[model samples]
Target: MSDTAAERAYRNCVRNLLAQFIHAVQQQPPFILDECDEESLHYLEQLESLPGTTGNEYAELGQAVVCRTIAAFPHLVPLLPRDLLWHFGGDCLHYMPDDEIDKFQQLDERLHQAIGEARPFDYERERAAIFGLH
Candidate 1:
């Protein structure tokens, strides 16, 4: 099946977030890499080498790194972008409660609607509103 508009938007968000993350790690490699397991490092290496690739190309590897980071270094969880968990879905969902998932789904729907209408959509602001953050 073809991807829906929402799916495309979600993929774009994930790709942008993942790229930002990779850039951050590249900037301060040792700080993050010293704690990563061999598998995570390998995935990061693969992802880092393919700069500017589409989300589909590196998303699974990005997901692997995110999942491994959560499992191997729980303390780093806060450092990792929270939106990535919702955008990546699959194994990443294991870390989020059902309520949080619902909120993310709602946020995505709102984002899609905004896009469909050509209205401005501030993702972080919308997300904070949905999550009841100040």
Candidate 2:
């Protein structure tokens, strides 16, 4: 389906954020492997103790890096997809010049409410409803 202009804008902004995040992750290791201590070492041991023990920290590092990177893009908060916006609570991590958390929260609330207005699709029933013949 074709997206509306606003939707396109939102999607593009998110894609930009994702692109920047990926670039950052590629440039830096996901975590401070050099900074690991007794506590962190235990955490790693516990992680490795789990069923799948490939012993690589890449997955965990990748997640932390992605989250931190996303958090950096605060300006993109208001334009994030509804699902992602809900998850972030309207906070974008890195977009420092525009971190109006309250404003983004308000926008998130309104957008989610609008999303809630869309009922589950029922082709035949919806067609009848639109034609006033249900």
Candidate 3:
């Protein structure tokens, strides 16, 4: 191929890759990690380790699952990447700005409820909204 054609092809490949990555990342895939199992959860609950709140499993989890799970469990907070935590942080690490605090609290509550009830939610739009990608 000509140099111009080769350059165009390479650029197209990069664009295609970027589109795919964005699509996958925006989908807010489930967080049913291999380690978080029902058997273990039951054992933890029996041991009074898992707080009895929602009494639900984290199956088909939503985008907020990561944050909400960490909140519900608290122990997982340290496991999360600092950047991901910052991505959701508006000002302080745990609080949003004054004007948006209400909305932030509302969202937090929703995540808590979802995590408690193990509700399945497609957070593609939510993720996109966070990054202002779409």
Cα lDDT computed for each candidate against the true fold: 0.71, 0.39, 0.39
In candidate 3 the C-alpha lDDT for residue 16 amounts to 49
Pitting candidate 2 against candidate 3, the one with the higher TM-score is 2
| Per-residue lDDT value at 23 in model 1 | 76
Give the C-alpha miss distance for residue 85 in model 2, angstroms: 6.9
State candidate 2's TM-score.
0.32
**In candidate 3, what residue range of length 10 has the lowest lDDT sum?**
53-62
Residue-level lDDT tens digits of model 3 in 1-134: 22343334433443444344334333332323546666445433332321222213321121244345354645544444333333235323452344345544454454455555555433334434544557
Better of 1 and 2 by TM-score: 1
Taking all chains together, each candidate's TM-score versus the true structure is 0.69, 0.32, 0.25
- Can you write out model 1's per-residue Cα lDDT over 17-134, one digit (the tens) per residue? 7678767655554446557567657756765654455467656765676787777656556667889887667799999999989999999899878767766667767778999997
Q: Using lDDT as the measure, what is the rank order of every candidate, best first?
A: 1, 2, 3
| Clashes per candidate, residues 3 or more apart or on different chains | 0, 9, 0
